[model samples]
Target chain A: MSERTAAPAGQADGRTDDQADRRADRRAERRAERQAEEGERRADPRRRNNRAWLLVLPVVVSVAFTAVIPLMTVVNFSVQDIFSPGDRLFVGLEWFRSVSRDPEVRAAFVRTLLFSAQVLLLEIPLGVLLAVSMPRRGVWVSVTLVLVALPLLIPWNVVGTIWQIFARPDIGLGGWAVNNVLGLEFNYTLDATDAWITVLAMDVWHWTPLVALLAYAGLRSIPDPYFQAAQIDGASAWATFRHIQLPRLRGVLTIAILLRFMDSFMIYTEPFVVTGGGPGNATSFLSILLSKIAVGQFDLGPAGAFSLLYFLAVQIVCYVFFTVLTRTGR
Target chain B: MADIRLEGVGHSYDGGRTWALRPMTWTWRDGRAYALLGPSGCGKSTLLNIISGLLSPTVGRIWFGDREVTGVPTAGRDIAQVFQFPVLYEEMSVYDNLAFPLRNRRRPKAEVDRRVREVSRLLGLEEHLRRRSRRLDPGRQQLVSLGRGLVRADVAAVLLDEPLTVVDPAMKWTLRSELKQIHRDTGHTLIYVTHDQTEALTFAEEVVVLNDGAIVQAGEPSELFLSPAHEFVGHFIGSPGMNVLPAELLDGVVRVGDATLGRASVELPSGPVRVGVRPEFVRIGPAGAASGPVARVTGVDRMGAYNLVHAEVNGHPVIARTDAATTFDAGATRVLRFAEGRAFLFRDAVRCGALEPLDGRAGA
Candidate 1:
């Protein structure tokens, strides 16, 4: 087998073989040299200057244009005044003083704080209980979770509008049923206490599901081994929650609390539609007050200043919450 | 201290469509460490969960001491469990993690501190008390769970369910030994679950070998290793598994395809059966014997200390452990013979009481 094939291949050698072999060898040498050079290039780790930030430059610019620019404009307007359309005068802290002394602004601040606190206190525990009781699997779980999330998807204005008509004493189901069946006169438009309670109930109805959903996701994320370990440790149900479940859910719960607080603090649409911040400004939170100053009065100078201060207050609260919870590692 | 008894304990997952654990009875004495060993999905973890009151048996009763506590809740049962993954409060310090159970019971501060320190010393975690459990490595976090379970000695029992399955291989041996030492010192009725035979054999005094949700064998570790009652047990217990050869029964003699598989020296049943012999018992040498079965070498796998010689005998794969010093090229023909009385014969999958004297299904 070797002799027959070897004879033909050897016969074709001669001068062509010598020239072809040299050319092939040189090409091989050049290729090897190029590879070696490439290898050395890769080996020099310090030479690579990863310009990855360039990829996110567009995102940074977009955020600056849409968010940071407007925010800065508010800040600028807060410290200055336009005497007659475009003629500016710097008043410094005068607007802050005027807004702080205004009973309307003071009332809004207190109302916002009370609303946020009340929502947080009511929703957190209830949400956690609902989450713990919810089944972890099967078709029923999917259905229940989807249903719970339905209210969160409704637009704020629509939620307000729906509740407004539903709570009318003459025709609305809630007011009419309560008046007829319970024999009580509960009118949100005429009573401050009634308006406050109505607003709280609306906020609870609209947002409790969010906290429950987040808490449920947190519960589901806990590994089974933890429960097993707790069982072996002879821990009671409450102990398990305090020691294992609560700690594991801390990050999610913090986020939940912050989200609920921020949303409740800035709540305007629902109360505005339902009671128009009335029962005599009983539910006029800071957001509503800013809108009142800007749109109702059209005093852009003082209103812009008030809005900027409002933004700073919200930022400060969020920043403080973040720092305290995160730095202490709770 | 108490003895655990499971009488007629069995479970079905789909209302009897599939059984997760078959009818089984066993007794685990107080202060004795026991291991339920099996492969994954072999119902080892299920059994552990049942014993811990995390699962209820469809038909059975579990007793701790003289009391029938099968229907008791987990909180009332008093069994401490260490999970496969560490379940720690990430927000709490290791100190808090260890003290949580004691605090829940409203134990005195001094007693809590003493117990926590003792467990911390035992686990070498005293210095890490102030660190958050989440910041620790998975191994150390698991140790905290272990410490928590061990913190209360007055508890009924301690159950560990494959706790070392997630541990690093380098640390596995050390932790296994530590667990064994802890058991020895505490004298707790420990029921550990693991699929790995080595861990079960080394850590447990008696191993309950399970397969397909049934108790195939239960005895001392050596007994199960030396005399397995079922083909599954024999295959599951040993490191390399037993070599089973299909054979025909004729006039009380077992014939492997063509060649006779030595004498049982013990009685034999007349039927189609399998002859079982461990790879360690097989003798291999050059092909000039002119006796026993003639085998052609197929390949060799070099284990750390020995070579697993793979060979084909009459078209059947046979494995034998050859000495590290011996060398054989592929395709080389070699003669193989089993030790005189080591051959085990199985009818269907159950050990026939006739072969190898049965040995009472030792080495569980």
Candidate 2:
């Protein structure tokens, strides 16, 4: 049977280069024929273009109305100097340069970076510690989760208002306690250090729970086998945390850092309500500075330029953070 | 290596109301491979954890080479374990994962490097030592996990909880043989836990069969096959397993239905007894041949090398294993005979003794 089949195949290959080229042509023809047969076999009336975009058309329309239009307006304002409603002059890159060169804007940019750094440095470890110490199972798990998430549930402006009242030296409990119990003359209204500390504390109180909740989720996702294996491997508590827990929590911690960084860098409502960028502009972060330019001074060009720069800065940081996290994760 | 002894060990995830592992005592000798074989949720993992000190047995003491380690944490107790799923330090390289245990014990860098290289080479992970552990395939990751367990020299016993469960099917056999070779070479006191009978029977020197949180039988693979101490063991060990028939014991003879099958080696109590014989030992012949009890062939399953003949003898189902040469048609009458000396008699589900052929017509 093999010899009979091979005879024709051998005869077909008896010619040299010319025959080989003809055989190749035949092979290509066979392939094309096979593909056409397959295409015919797979042909179905249901294989029509459904145009699924119609389903999401409402969402797209709303997003264009809410986000795209406002962003376009900002971009438009950014490249032109708008003196009045209809009085505008196209002046590209001038506003961006002025905003970048302003000493106050530079100070606020630096302070924003330092503030985000401080928030991350303080909140990440504290949140992880809180998550680790929280009850892992049973009735108390829900209770602890709710309690930790309590601050995150508050509206940002409401948080600012609560802290505003809570930090008043004459009436509030915190300021009164610090003043009378510790005998340290503390007043956030007049002192730059006091204002910075109060703003930092308020930010920590409000956002640390977000980090804690994320870390808790990360901790919970780890299977019990890892811990059991670590225990059986004779790993100490610190070793287990360093090798097992921390490495496992890398993705979550990265997200938490990114979230806290962006949120803290663009913090506005709470500090604005509580400090009002007061105590000689001590707690004036980027958003507060941006608000003062856009609303207080009505400098749309510089504020628009600053907003774009801020958006780019956040994107760059997030990209770097995400890349570092995923690379290390692998 | 140290011998591990469990005295009256029992565990309860709940506080002593119900037991996951019933109170039992056993000893694992030094430098030997043992297998804990059971179905899922049979407390095999619970037992492995108790021995490894991951779980404190509620009512017992554990001793390692005469030192009581019942109160010691898992880290303090000298043991290593590989889990069902590979538990590698995902961020670490294969070399670091193998070195982790030794480094945690503060072993010198030189010693850690030497042992890591040695075990990695042993597990065929020498070329991939610098690669991140999580990037490897599941089989290689599991090998890395096994290497981590093997790298530590001071552990009393290495506990493996179905370590090959996640490995690919084609790789499982190779890994199992490699593990067997590793056991022979290292002389480590290894306790492997698996639900796979093939894995248990082939890998371990002694197999402890468990069912419903209690040990059914503990013996060598051949002994388990030949003389299963419990009916569960008889049913669980083999592919088709042993066929258990309800019978009556009167005088010295065992009667299944109306046929006098054989005589018990020991005088069994005059009551109900289950006669068990492996399918391989159940012989089938033409009916009315004056050879053995008669049965009707119900079905035949051609399983490649052998044919499994399912038959009914006086309303009781029986399975006889025959080679490809032997053929049986469904609904045909045949004579089924239990091979003498291979037939087991069980009283109240516990094995009593074997049955001897009454007349000398064993192979007829």
Candidate 3:
């Protein structure tokens, strides 16, 4: 049966059948052309490779280089000790114990923790309230924003120097006004309690704007419709703030907390310049204590160990805060 | 259960020196659906804001029931507003989003839960109660926003500001009908704002049309459609808009170029007049069928559902919405006649002239 179907061996009848075969070949070619055209319509290659990863790779690389590398280096230094050039020593838990027992280190740790908590309690709500009370969509808004951001522009070192002179007992305006005009016995250099007040005042003056700016951005981003919805629901003013404004500002408030906490924990500049950790170590925070260990006493082993412990403490607090914030907000 | 009254209430941003909303005096009775309809920048949103008590009027006063609430803040005024864009606490779960207002008011937790569950069922969000609002689609997000507004039944009024604009086309009809159903279910005084005429006409019992910064017309939907107070409203409310023709008012007759429309004398100031008529009211193609001026067909567009026939009468372009059954070749010279009493004449853009006979009326 297969041989008969393949029979082009004959002459007259085979030629006639061959002409029919040529016609069938033409029909099959036409069908294939139509199928090819249909296939072209069905699949489009241009739309498949529109991946946007190429555009995002540079940012990923930059973050890794800048953030990840320094963090790993810090981790490495935290666990190891260096003695002289090209020499290393690894004493497990030795330096950690020594630093933890040091009286000065323990005092600075407690002081730093207390200061950060105080600043956080005072600033967050005050900043949020100020933002809520502000007028929306007017010339006054622009003026207010510029005024609030002005203090934030002054350099940290500059702020410390300015307050140092300003709080002088004789020549400085703030000192003279406090002692003479208000009739208060105030000497930031001579009194320990006065030194604490001056340091707190300086911190608030320099950093309140940061909280205010974050909170203000959050408040302004709220749509007018939300307020209208709250009104229709018969919510009270405090109710509106608690439900709408406060919830909307949670992310920014968390950022404000984390940044302010880290910054406040490591605060050394303003207090260092104002009293030089004077008044009998009244305002010595962790950073100042660590600097004293490394530069003043020249004890690299204990100081580096102490610095590592301080870093871990700050990181642990910040990590706990981040976890709590992400959990509640989600 | 309170009726709102606005007696000549107006607002301006720059110390009342420049007006954003011209004087508006109206009342919204209890349980009625009212819509403030306008193009963008026409002060409809401003009026909605003022009524919500988020903004105080620069002039006049607003009253909720008998008590004037012109000086109250948004929180003190018991009103609900749904915005064009959904505004929700993205970090919160659907349950918390609905319960927050109640919780903040120091309501009992049991009451809050009951209210949240009830609203969730109403909005078809019971299954997604545990999910965060930010994870929802834009449609679901808008539903969350709407649910937040509608959860409390004791609110004085519910103000919706183009709430359905962000919704996809396929979901709009269902959502719109759902809103109408919600209104029927709960007799809350509803004030809806939209630029889309179809949504406004279908959802609202009374429609207020605004232009520039003033209310051009306010009436029932049918009345506004049949007789617009100003030329702007006449052109704005209809699809494809009304064809405005330059005309001259002589005595009582309105003349378009060489042709004239026979009507009663108009008591209008003598100046340029514009003749207005809806496309459906204009009859074309050898029109001895109606008693009006004649026109020539200029263009014909065969839509799948209907035929939009364009014509030129007395050198002014006239558009006619004809039945899909009527087939006319493009550029065919056809007679155009106006349906008797369906024509309107305007002077200086205001309806200062006489109206034509009503469309489809006897002997029209």
Per-residue alpha-carbon lDDT of candidate 1 for residues B53-72, written as tens digits (9 for 90 to 100):
89999999999999999999
Taking the candidates in order, what DockQ does each have?
Answer: 0.39, 0.59, 0.31
Candidate 3 residue runs with Cα over 4 Å from true position: A1-97, A100-103, A129-143, A165-194, B63-77, B89-122, B125-137, B140-156, B265-272, B287-294, B352-364
TM-score of chain A for candidate 2?
0.81
Q: What is the TM-score of chain B alone in each candidate?
A: 0.92, 0.96, 0.92
Q: Which one wins on TM-score?
A: 2
Highest DockQ: which candidate?
2
* Model 1 agreement with the true structure over A1-330: per-residue lDDT tens digits: 999999878776756778788999999999999999899889996777778879999999999999999988877777777666668899887887898788878878988988899999999998898888888888889998988888899999899888887777888898788788889897888988878888888888899999999999999998887776676556688878877777777788889988998899889899989988887788888988888877897767788778877887888988888778676653
> Per model, how much of the real contact set is kept?
0.75, 0.82, 0.57
Better by DockQ, candidate 3 or 1: 1
Q: Top lDDT: which candidate number?
A: 2
Quantify all predictions' global Cα lDDT against the true fold: 0.83, 0.89, 0.82
Please give the lDDT score at residue B270 for candidate 3: 56
List, residue by residue over B237-281, the lDDT tens digit for candidate 2: 998988988888898788887777888889767877889999989
What is the C-alpha lDDT profile of model 3 across A231-250, one tens digit per residue?
Answer: 65566788678778888898
Model 3 error, position B130 (Å): 5.8
Give the range where candidate 3 chain A is weakest over 10 consecutive residues by summed lDDT. A71-80
